[model samples]
Target: MIVCVAIVGHQNNPLYIQSFTEGDDALKLHHVVHCSLDVVDERVNNPKKSGPMLNETYLGLLYPTENYKVYGYLTNTKVKFILVTTDLDIKDADVRNFFRKFHAAYVDAVSNPFHVPGKKITSKTFAERISTIVKAFGLSSAG
Candidate 1:
């Protein structure tokens, strides 16, 4: 069975949420969201080779009014990762809508891909399209 976990935290803080599947050495996955690129990069690239290492990827989200941005990371159960960020002027509504669409597309695209692993998501058009959808959803001004 699949498990769903959600976490809520300040945009300026480190946020983490995890879920565990059932089986032998089942997936112990964790999702961490941070507001700083430097902090996230340091934690992911730290040389303290003790526990499992994470496979990382990055994405960027942009908001054109507030001069603020948000970065995200989607990691594997064995510490695999996907990182993303916004450019600037990011509004809360824009961020929320982006995740709503991004999460939907992830379930449809990534989960359905027949590749092995370590595939990077570098589609700027896709990101932009998603951003447009977010704006169309009336979330661009809700905040």
Candidate 2:
């Protein structure tokens, strides 16, 4: 199941974060997402190992934790979508599906005239859509 989600800007700064697990672990989850940036950077610079980075926007697995596995997707504009889940053996196609939906939601969020680029997303529509998407992964907000 997806336990946490984050949208980060090109500068490595977090724009939004949502967690499906209870407690004050959002901070910890943020660190987890932040650390994954290095992996994204590695793949970005060494694109060959990951195939044609220009065509394949999905960066796939960023890293795995004892309790969760992190997946990352990069946009041409340098924005990033990071997802953390307990499902260690998730398929690449499934991750791609998640990112495809997420990218659309992200685009919708940023396209809003009221939205300020690189800022936290506060759109209820975006949040609701994400809540539904996360439901497919089996959750919304934990506590």
Candidate 3:
């Protein structure tokens, strides 16, 4: 199950952070995502030099905690999708699908006339979209 989701800006600042874990574990989940940023940064700068780079967005599993694993996807515009899941062995396709849906939601949010690119997303409809994504994927819920 997904424990947290984060939308990180190009400059490494978190634009949005959603914790799916209940109570104190939420804090721990945030830290896990925060630490995973370093791995995302490294992968962005020095991507695997061997394989055919069809779409360099999916960075794969960044790192693992005892209870969760962090997965990262970087958009062309440099926004990041950081997903923390309780399952350590989550499939790459699942992560990709989630990020794909997330990307669409992000685009929709940014397309709003009053929305700013780097600011935190506060749209109720956008939040609902994300919540639906979590439910569709049988993810955990926040406290």
Q: lDDT of all predictions, in order shown?
A: 0.37, 0.84, 0.83
TM-scores of all candidate predictions against the true structure: 0.34, 0.89, 0.90
Error of 3 at 79 (Å): 0.6
Query: What are the runs in model 3 whose C-alpha is more than 4 Å off?
Result: 139-143
In the range 1-143, model 3's lDDT, one tens digit per residue, is: 77789999999888888987666687777788889888988886776666676458888888877777888889999998998888746667777888899899989999999998788989999988998898776642321
Model 2 lDDT per residue over 52-116, tens place? 55557788888898888999999989998999988756668777888899999889889999999
Candidate 1 local lDDT, 1-143, one digit each (tens):
11212222223232222232344321322222222344444555673444443443222331111422334434333221222322334454554544556556544444545632335333455445544554454444444
For lDDT, the strongest prediction is: 2
Q: Give the TM-score of candidate 1.
A: 0.34
Q: By TM-score, how accurate is candidate 2?
A: 0.89
